[model samples]
Target: MVATQQTAGLSTSGRAVQAVALLLGFYLLAAAIVLGLLGLDLALYLGSDHLRPALFKIWALTAVVIYPVLRVVFLTRRPKGGESGGLLVGRAEQPALWARVDRLAERTGVRGPAEIRLTAEVNAAVREDTRLLGLIPGKRHLEIGVPLLIGLTEAELDAVLAHEFGHYSNQDVRLAGITVAGRTAIVHTIGTLHERADRQQAEDAAELRAEAEDRLARGKQPKDRSAGDGGVQRVLARLFTRYARLYFRVSESVGRRQEYAADRAAAEIAGRDATASALRKIPTLVAAQNFYLGAYATLGWDAGLLPAPGQVYGGFAKLLADPGRRAELAAMGLALPEREADPYDSHPPIAQRVAAIEALPADGRGTEGAGPALDVLHEPERTLAELEAVTLVPEAATKRRVDWPELVAESHLAHAREAAQPILRALTGSGLPGTVDALLDAVDRGEGRQLAERLPRSAAATAATGRAAREFLRPALRAGTARLVVLALAESGLARWELSWSAAPALVLPEGMAETFDAALDAVVADTPDTAPLRSLLVAAGLAPVAG
Candidate 1:
């Protein structure tokens, strides 16, 4: 990407300073809003008489407005830096990864994380348990994603790690906790206030409904009245919500600048080209891993089957190795991803980040040649298995595990069987035996159109009737019949699903049968149906009596 001046006029270090100031300002303003409301209410209560209803009402309303804020301030929850999610990898378990972390920490001029954890996300992160609003820095923790370890080159991995460590070097990690804590508390308080308002509104509606019912029963006209409920809570929520938005904008603006500083540090630690390359590949790698998981790894999830441990996590490597899939991913990697402009976007666009690195001179302490980042772990397979165990959902972990080949066959067979079920049900509803042979008999007897009409069709298929309906139903019928054929062939040991690493599972048949499999099924379900080729196929496979 060509470097631009408009978006990045300030130096990285200068932006870091400005972000620190904004963060401080955000906190100060938050404190002022809460204190200002409370102070005003206190003055009115202490200085003014309590006997006046209007004056007392004014004070009470002010108190209600400040109530949520007061709770946020005094009853704030302390930040536990590393609590939820991620499996903690002890130094003893993976000395190689820890050694690299320690080396990078020294280079970045910051102490390494006290604990390292592995997570299922696509990015790396650092967090500090800063005490007393970042004044006292406590335990530091680092989280590295499994995908990053498996997908990136060693230097690319280092660049990512360096960027996270940059937050520590820039002194932003300590204070980021406070900014995050403030946002969490503000958002929580607003949500609590809204819940209270909703409950009160529901109660008021129920009370009105009861009154109307009573009036209707007594032969009297129902009267209209205002609910006039939850007004205080609503007002309080609105006030806090505005403050929360401001806090988000200011803090996140700081967050964006901090990201640039971190990226700069990454570039200095790793080469400019390496840093830029890592930035480009991370998004694409994330996309590929997600696609692999949804399309391949969980194919048999409905049938309680999973890729054996390590395979679930390591299957992504197979995708990148495929020439066709690699080209697609490379194209995806070249373009920086775009999305709806959000105020809380904490990182600069990848294009801009890469361009910034491009502008820098080649002056980095980059290490040796490229290798898989997974090399950093001792016994990578064992570590990956452990990662899979921790990352997979509890139910997924309990699923029956199988090798990739068997997993593909079993999963696809399960899907085929499931798809055929609807057709069976449709046949039974029409006073038929609902067997494959019964379906063949009905089609042969010219009941195909009637049966097609009875089968479930999409709204688009709604317009089609008579001959048109049969045409629309052609694909569904053929698919159902194909499933039946595959089931029979498998039962008789004539066909099987062969694993294809680059594509979907292949339904392979015997030498002569493989070539005619599709043509046979098509001939069997054509508009003017012919079951001879299909019946011949069954006979050859030794499953006799195609139509019973």
Candidate 2:
């Protein structure tokens, strides 16, 4: 790690600034230590004093007891876990990937990381796990975004990997890890303070409510204060807020410098052209991944019991292959916030990164002999299945993978079921006829806006009725028939609504809406003395009356 060694033996000015930052961190630590000691001394002195002094000593003892506890809590609180944004791939699972990473690390003059992880994010990085406020270095891991792997050729992927490895080469791995720990500590402390403030506020509100109830019982007025932070919590919260802002400002400034240096190291290894393209493609691919995920959520959710990564990727690739969508996504990527310099941002804007890469000496290299980067994985299908198993909806775990056309049909069927449930529930009671009459009268009175607002907003029913009201209700209301109105609602989107030969209504809730309706129905049936009466009433009405 020649670059890391060079950074270590930095010039006097660089060394001075680094030393100042380190000293400031040490100063905070020393001040906490001094406060603890002072409180300890005061506690010891007050223990031997009279009652008046002992009362004051109690406050000192409180400080002495709480400081160490808070300090330890701040030091030991787990960082919000890393993004489980993708699946993990061990050496045994992806030998070729690991081998390539080894070659890149050796070329980049950085030690091989402890592990490599794959994610669905559009970025790659080398991160060292830090614990105990950075007193201990846990394992270092390399995380590569799967979308980036899919988008980039082998040469481009190599350049991105080299860029991450560059951080390790310059010992930014360790420096960044420690600073990240400090940032986490600051955030955790602030959160804890706010949480305490929240609890106090809640208790105060409850007490005030109780007092108001008592006053009302006695025929008296109640007084309440505006909600806000109170007592010592307010001061501590404000202090931490200011400190967090300052800490991030200073840290991100240094962090940006590290990014630039790492960029330079990456260029030195993988060539400027490759690095520049890789950086530019990152945001674009990120936008594409978002679109891809939306597609999965909509059309691919219930495909089959075993959807593989390749199938998922294939679906996404088809999405990207659309000329119209590709252009829209490319525009979105360009629109992402980055052009303006944000003082707290760790990486500079993409334009600035590109400029920096351009300023470097050009190496006459091309992306020759490059292939698809994802080919390095051993069993992509199985890997994809495993990843989906953990991340997909529970029902999806048992679904069998289906082709794209089948997926689309399933999605439509699911949506139809969701849309119809609330309508059927509303129809169940005797009051449904009266409700329908009022709705028709409202439509005749041109009170569509008011009627729309008053419609049941249960997820499936709301969407269904909304569509029907907008597109079909006017015609049905003009016909002045309950059956026609119901028919129009079904046609427009309320879902298939009809009567069975048994002369009772048969309704299917939209695929996902049944659970929601079931929960609501549970509450109604729970306290009823005889659900049988309700069931008979529903049967007599030809549709069960249930509150939406």
Candidate 3:
């Protein structure tokens, strides 16, 4: 029995490692493909017969020269150098921080002192080598950016450090540091390229718009209008737009995955809840820091818009004072807080991260915390069996059917009309009597589906709307199917839509229909022979199946 148990444990550990390795492999493969494509595009563009090789060479050379010059200008124009050494563990003058770090190191059984570092941003990282002059193995270093240390409470700070030490103790810190360095380098390269492309795009757009306007002014038919003297401008605009989109999309994807990996590592080191709390806190600190920096820059005190020293610390203090603001911010995103620059985002949305973490079992065991973190983590086969036993029923037939009038009344189409009322009233008040009313009435009663059918059907519109419905609306509706059924009946003339488990004639009652909609959906789908496929479809749509 002991030997069997040991073998089972080894097998589970091996699987966990395989899972993480697979994910990392996929990421590297994607990065390589993207880089390859980019290289190919550059070669083709530069070598094209239509474009002179010498001219292309000169342009590339000029771009290379301009990039660093702009980078230096941007960096130099920002605030000058601040404190560069490790930020003292606690308060600037407090000795308790170091004491606490010593205690944590002793508890974790990791060698080396924690080398702290201060930065405006809220972050803590474990560096393997602290001595700037030489490489040192087994000499681990910890840097807690001042902002993060100041933001977290003593316990929270300890939790953060423990999490870092978890990496060190597990011998994962070196690997993580290497990954970070590689990602940073890639992101920086992409960022530089994106910036240059954006600048070029702005210039190209202005030139194209001017040329198009000029052609229009000359009374040339729209189709007859040439690109004018800005052929190069038009090409550059197209190229830049394509590059900008590709760069951001790829960067955001990679960034989100890296964040997940890091979060998982942190959770393994610290308790899940503690890690969650730290993730929640950093956003508010960052926001506060940003606000202060903006204010400082506006007042001409700071050199640029970046956060000032101690700004995050001040922000944390404000949150401590205003509990309401703190709660609001905490609730903003459970995993990853939203930021203004989402295009260049290097992390997943907070809500997604929270969901992922919540999915983990309570315990911190398992390789990279990928398996059930709960005590007695279930075998994969057992887990599958359990899931199969908890069969779900579709909502459509289980609940009462909605009538056409009620559906129309409760739909977003009606909401849009209601929203447009004020604008129409304002237009009428401004002396456009009777003009806005006709438009408003026409819009309010417009049947999107009917209009779609009547219009000269474009294959493109059909494909696009189908894709949108499948990709976006279907999932959204499934997510809130129960609430949607209730809401639909409540807001409509319908009255009877309740969920039911048994087979029954689902009626579209004028009242109380909301209570029956779930039952109606289940009955409709359950009667079908291919219940398994039907249930899968409903699940994909985001609906919960009936208990029966």
Tens digits of per-residue lDDT, candidate 1, 1-548, equal 23544344334335445445655654565578677877876777688665568767876776666665556544656454448477788889989999999999999999889999888788899988887666577889899988888888899998999999999977777657667766666677677778888888888988988998999999988888757557677766787778777777767777777888999999888778778888989989888888899878888899899988887887777777788888887788787766543567767678878788889987654454388898998887777788887778889867998988889888877876787777777788888875667777888898876676666789978787777777798887787777777776765667778877677778886667777878987876787898778777677766667444
Query: Model 3 over residues 111-230: C-alpha lDDT tens digits?
Result: 745355433356676666422111124455566555554456554565567766765555444443333433443344445545555666676677777877887899864343333433
Compared with the true structure, model 3 gives a TM-score of: 0.37
Error of 3 at 390 (Å): 59
Ranking by TM-score: 1, 2, 3
* lDDT to native, each model: 0.78, 0.61, 0.45
Residue 405, model 2: Cα distance from true site in angstroms: 1.9
For model 1, the superposed segments whose C-alpha errors exceed 4 Å read 1-84, 195-235, 338-343, 363-367, 459-475, 491-493, 509-527
Clashing pairs in 1: none
Please write out the lDDT profile of model 2 over residues 1-548, one tens digit for every residue. Answer: 99866656573236335534653664475366457767776776666655576656666756754564355344545667574556777888899999999999999887788887776567888887766444356688888876776777777888899888887766676666556756766677667767777787888778888888999899988875555554456556666677678777777777788788888887888888888777877888876777666655345454342324456654455555567766776676455555786788888887888788978877886564277776777886666556555555567656666655445544545555454444334433324443343433333445543433343544544465655544443322222223333433344455453322122224543444444433432322232212233233233434434232
Greater TM-score among 2 and 3 belongs to: 2
